[model samples]
Target: MSGIYIHIPFCKQACHYCDFHFSTSTKKKSQLVEMLCEELELRKDEIGRNIQTIYFGGGTPSLLNSEELDHIFKTIFEYFKVSETAEITLEANPDDLTEEVIKMLNASPINRLSIGVQSFFGKDLKLMNRAHNSEEALRSLQLAKHYFDNISIDLIYGIPGQSNEQWKRNLQQALELDIPHISSYALTVEPKTALEKFIEKGKVKPVEDEQYREQFDILVETLTSKGFEHYEFSNYGKPGYHSQNNMAYWLGKPYLGIGPSAHSFDGRSRKWNISNNSLYINSIQAGKLPQQTEELSTTDSYNEYVMTRLRTKFGVNLEEIQEKFGEKYKLHFLKEADRFLQDGLMDTSEETFHITPNGKFLSDGIAADLFYIDK
Candidate 1:
């Protein structure tokens, strides 16, 4: 089955560390919603399979009023063949999930709520320039659990001055809430973000590698002990609560991504829409897609496969690689993986290559070393 992702490129405010394509202004909110529906209709024939998942991700999907959300959902049901039990998710910010908003969302088709509760502490909130406070974060989850059973919350670790004890407390809070799914990530300093600027100006200390590694280890150990499956490098889920949309992405299933800065991938090619909201709306109004496409070369496909699969619990399937790509790619992969395997960074079982706990934090570097670079 396929999936659909709709990016709502608007937010109430900008977080210092965020570099995603989003606008702080809501002036184009209505126009953008309409254009999104139009884009969905325009690309209705792209996915040949029934839609099994629909994800509303972005700057903050919760910023949309109930009517706007309804309009998008109505358009989706009208244009696409959605499965009877499709998993629908919406990413929300804590401050936007008020009682009224929660009530409205309960009436909508969204079955899952992925709350952006990065941290449960006031110091961390202010440091990131988050729109919500610690109180709002706690209250939002308390209110949300009353209505939505399938919920996930984000947590950030390795803030410049955040200690391991603070990180443990964040984990404890999530466990106390009994959230079914948790997506935690390290605080990365992307280029051009305000965080990078602060670091450059020496106003904020940079994240230390040792601190980041320590927190990551704590996250894996704590969650796994609590029966949360470390299914992905940055995601933990309890039993059946794994993110279907994200799983579809990892499995390389085709999906249609609507809205500015969104991406779509078929088996052989990948496409991304322009990152500008106004340009996207204008182009859609003119009956043209404001996007670019690239055909994946054999080496490009192999490298991508290695990158995505290595970060997952399933690791890399050698048989699938040989059958899908060629014997040459498979042999090249085995030769590259030998060093990591000997270094206690990876292991093989039933002909599958998976990362060991000792190598989890360094998965990205390991995957890169195994990349199929062309001569």
Candidate 2:
């Protein structure tokens, strides 16, 4: 089964650390939605399989009123073969989730709500320049959980001044809420973000890797002790509550991404839509898809397999690697992995090649080293 993702690239405000493609000024909000609908119709035949999930992700899907959401869902139903019981998810901000909006969303085709409750501390919220306060964040979650059982919350850890105690408190608060799914991520200063510039200007302290390590350990231990499955590296879910749409990607299932800065994959080649909102709208208005496609070469495919699988809890399967990429590549990887395996960074069962707990911190570096370069 395939999935569909629609990026609503508009937000009420900008988060300091965020570098995602979005516009704070939503002057073209109406036109943007219309173009997304058009893009849906234009690429309907790209996926030949039945849609198992439809995710409303973006700058802020909760920014959309009921009417806008309805129009988009209606268009999706009309154009695509959506499963009768497809997992429809809408990513939302806590500030926008009023009781009225929650009630409206309950009646809509949307089945899940992934709220961005980054922190429950006002001071921490201000540090991140988040739009929601602690009170609103808690209220929004409570209101949505009343109607929707399948709820997920996003939490951020490792802000500049955030301490280990504060990080643990945040995790405890989330656990107390009994959220079915929790996505926790460490703060990284991505290049060109406001956070990065602030660090360069000495307005804010840079992220400390030591602090990140402390927070990450706290996160893993606390969540696992509470019986949450560390399903993906950054994602945790209660029994049987894992995100189906995201799981599809981790499992290498095909999906179609629509709207500005969105990416799509058909299990081989991948395509990305233009990040410029006006350009995206203009191109679709001109009866064209604003996207660039890349055909995945054998080496590209092999490297992707290593990267994605290594980050997962299931780890990399050597047999599948050998089967799909050939025995030569598999043996080469096995030989290359010898050093890491002996150094306790890699673990190998007869069936899988996984990273040990100590190896997770250096996962990216290890994956890069394991990458297949053109010879």
Candidate 3:
């Protein structure tokens, strides 16, 4: 099934480690919203099918006002065939999720909430420059739980000063809140971000790979022991609470990504809109799609499929690979995966291959090693 992703690229302030495309100044938000609507109209025919999931990801989607949200929804419903039971999700920040906002969101079409609660500790929040304080984080989550049943929260571990005790406390806090789904990730210091600069200037300590690995194990053990499924590497969900939009994307289902810097994937190719807001607005206003398209070669598609599937419980199927990509790719995959399997980093049962316990933290690197660079 196909889905749609709407990116709202405005934030209250820049987080230290975030390198996502967003503007802190929201003066142009209203204009950008109009452009997004126009772009939706422009791209409706791309899907040509009923949308099963709709995701409002961001700089911060919770920042959208009721009127702004309504306008976008109206535009979507007008042009697109959305399923009656579509899973609609919004990514929100704790600082922005006051009771009134939560009530409004519950009243709207959004049925899922992914709150940005990077850490439950003030020290970690401050170090990451999160917009919310610790108290606000807890308060917002409790409030959201009252309004929504399908709730997810984003948490980051392995901050510069975060101890194992602190990380455990954060997970404990999430459990106490009774959140159904969680999207937890290790803090990566992206180039040109404030965190990288801080490390270079000696204002922040460099992130430790060992620390990340330790915390990752703790995350897996704690959540899975509590009956949460490690569905994807960075995601944990109780039964029936997994993110539909995420599943759609990972399963190679087509999706039309709306708004600036967003991406779209058809069965054959992928494309992305321009990252600059002004340029995107101008281009959409002029009735042009400000995006670049790349037609995927068979090798590109196969590599992507292998990369995404290996990290999940749904392992790569050798039979499907052979059937879809021919004997050459299946043979190449098996040959490359042999070393990892022998190293005890990968496991195969019947025709499917999955990440072993020792290989979970290194899934991405292992996937990279298996990627065939077409010469």
Candidate 4:
């Protein structure tokens, strides 16, 4: 099924390692929302399907008040065919979550809440420059659980000084709370980020890949023992609680993405909106969609398929490949894949080729190697 992703390009504060496009000022909030709504209406026919999920993701979607949120949802309903049983989600930060806000969200059509609880430790919070403290982080989940059962929380590990014991404690705490889904991430220092600068200046320690791998292994073991399925590389879910919106991406479904810096993908190509807030608004006001797009060549399409599908539990299907790209390309794909099979990174039978547990950590690299070059 298809989905919709709306990027709310605003945040109260910037985290040290974040590279996402967002503004700390609320001066352009109304204008931004209006532009987003207009973009939604403009791209209606491009994605013609009953949307099964609508994800409000961003710097922090909870920054918007109930009225603004309502306006966006109403516009989506007006311009798009949303399923009656669609899974609508909002990505919230702990500091923005309060009893009143929770009540407003519960009243709305949003069925899922993905709270950003990067760490429950005050020390870790300070290092990341998250807006919320440990107390608010814990309280947000407690208060949220009272109202919503379909909840997913995010956690970060492999911080500069995070011990293995502390990482284990984080997962244990989530299990104790009975969270249905969790999205755990390893901290990486992206170029030009504050974290990268800190490391370069020797003001902060750089990330240890070995330590990160250790933590990742702990994550897989701990979550699996807790009866959570490692559905994707960084996602774990309880039975029947997998995220429908994320699954749409892995299944290669066509979806519309609205707002500044949001990305959309149809099976054949990809498109993304402009990252600059004022520029995007100006373009849309001039009745032009402010975006860049690319038509995927066969080689690029096959590479993307291997990269995304390999991350999911449902591996790549052989017959589907043959059907889509033909027998010759499928055979070439298998020939290239044979290299990884010998290394025990992937397992294959006559019908399916799935990454092994050992292969999960090296997914990106292996997928890169499997990329096809057009002749």
Tens-digit per-residue lDDT, 1-375, candidate 4: 678999999999989999999999989998899888899889888878578999999978999888888889899899888899899999999988999999999999999999999888899999999999999988999999999999999999899999999998988888898999999998988988998888999989877899999999999999999899999998999998899999889888898989999999988889999999999999999999998999998777777888898999888888988887778768877898898899899998767888898888998888887777766
Query: lDDT per residue, candidate 2, 1-375, as tens digits?
Result: 899999999998889889899999889998999898998988888986489999999999988887788889888888888888799999999999999999999999999999999899999899889999999999998888889999999999888888889888888888888998999888789889888888999999887788888888889899989999887778999997889998888778899999999999998999999999999999999999999999998789889888878887878888898888888778878888889999999999986988888888777788888887888
Spell out the clash pairs found in candidate 3: none
Per-candidate Cα lDDT values, in order, are 0.95, 0.89, 0.94, 0.90
Give the per-residue lDDT digits (tens) of candidate 3, residues 126-221. 989999999999999989989999999999988998999899999999998889999999899899999999999999888688899999999999
Model 3 scores a C-alpha lDDT of: 0.94
Candidate scoring better on TM-score of 1 and 4: 1
**What TM-score does candidate 2 get on C-alpha atoms?**
0.98
Over 4 Å off, model 4: none
Clash pairs, model 1 backbone? none
**Index of the highest-lDDT prediction:** 1
TM-score of each: 0.99, 0.98, 0.99, 0.98
Q: Per-residue lDDT for 124-230 in model 1, tens only?
A: 99999999999999999999999999999999999988999999999999999999999999999999999999999999999889999999999999999999999
Give the TM-score ranking, best first: 1, 3, 4, 2
Q: Which ten residues in a row have the lowest lDDT in candidate 1?
A: 41-50
